[model samples]
Target: MQEISYKQKVLKEAKRQGIISCWFFLANFAASFLIAVYKAFTQPHTLKQLQNLELIDSVITNLTTLAATIYIWLAIKKLADIYDTDVYEIFIKAVIAVVLAIFLLLALGLEGITPGAVKAVSYVLVGIGIYFFILWFKLNFALAKITNNKLFKTYVFFAIISAVVGGAIKTLAMFGFFEGGVYMLAAALSIAILYVLPTAFYLYAWTMIKEE
Candidate 1:
């Protein structure tokens, strides 16, 4: 077999990441849109109907998330060679943890869930978020190590800014510091960050891709 150089490897990885990013955005977008339509149409006039609808939504969301995790994992296992990192294992573990956490989060959204369960599960979610932090760190570290590209760093901060500012606004609104419209805006902003901001940065990074 012909020995491939570093530039070839980087290019291959870049192309792979580009494909992965598109699928990530599309799959999540479809899931989000379907969820919106489901919530809009599934308004129940009776207790049993409400329970059934909620169950269906949970299954839909969980399956979509599971698919996303697996699809992203395919891209992830490719990256262990791009930057020579050991995060493939970490990535697998994080995905497992996050899938569980997401289920817990969805349960918390259920109508009659207890406050005690919510409180306890909220802390567990935060702990699970730490796994995400580790995953993010590994990705950025690998990117920085492989190329001189600083776009990942920018993506990182803007992503964080979106979450922090949005969360603060949402929290204040919840505390009665704002009205309905403001609260809605805050919620939208947070969701937008979680879903849209990364894709924006990801596409930009691809435009600026270089061998390094």
Candidate 2:
């Protein structure tokens, strides 16, 4: 039997491991969501109104972290196919990326140096930058393993597009683009859509690249 080409092997492993990684993320999201609901329901009546904000924010952050972890695993799986690297190595790298991203955001948020006028803006920028960096690193590394091209470029392209879309939607919502008490829900849904859309696009791009 003809042996599988290196590219085919990497792609196949990536696909299989990607499925596992996605399932893991789904499980994490579900658990986080349940926890958020529990927290919301059991909280004080006065805090119940605030519960949605806190709980939903927590859920979104946790889901984002879970997704990052899975991407890191996918990257490591790809590397293993190419270099026979141990899974532990991938886990370490992924952890490092996630930790660094979180650290950056926390540091920026707590710095207390920026002026009040720009503090919120700075924090937002730091958070977005950290997230985009981790995502770009993970996706580019995985794509590089599959095809030795400029993976980072494509990753950044899709990432910026996603951010723009997400930001625009949030801005409009904040400016009363949506009426009624459902604005918060609209914002949350926009965030969810933003998070998934880019990943979906990247997956499609990767598939097309692999088929070539």
Question: Which has the greatest TM-score?
Answer: 1
* RMSD, one per candidate, in order: 5.0, 6.6
- Those runs of model 1 whose alpha carbons end farther than 4 Å from true positions after fitting are 5-14, 25-60, 99-128, 177-183, 206-208
Q: lDDT by residue for model 1 over 1-212, one digit each (tens)?
A: 23357646755675466556555565665566565556555554488866766676667666656665564566556556655566567767766787798699899989988889889999999988887887876676555555566876777777777778767766776788866556555655656666566666765765565643
Deviation in angstroms for 14 in model 1?
5.9
Candidate maximizing lDDT? 1
Residue range 60-131, candidate 2, lDDT tens digits: 767766775676477556756655435445456546655766665676666555676366656666776666
* TM-scores of the candidates in the order shown: 0.65, 0.54
The global Cα lDDT (0 to 1) of model 2 is 0.59
Clashing pairs in 2: none
Deviation in angstroms for 123 in model 1?
A: 6.3
lDDT of 2 at 78: 70
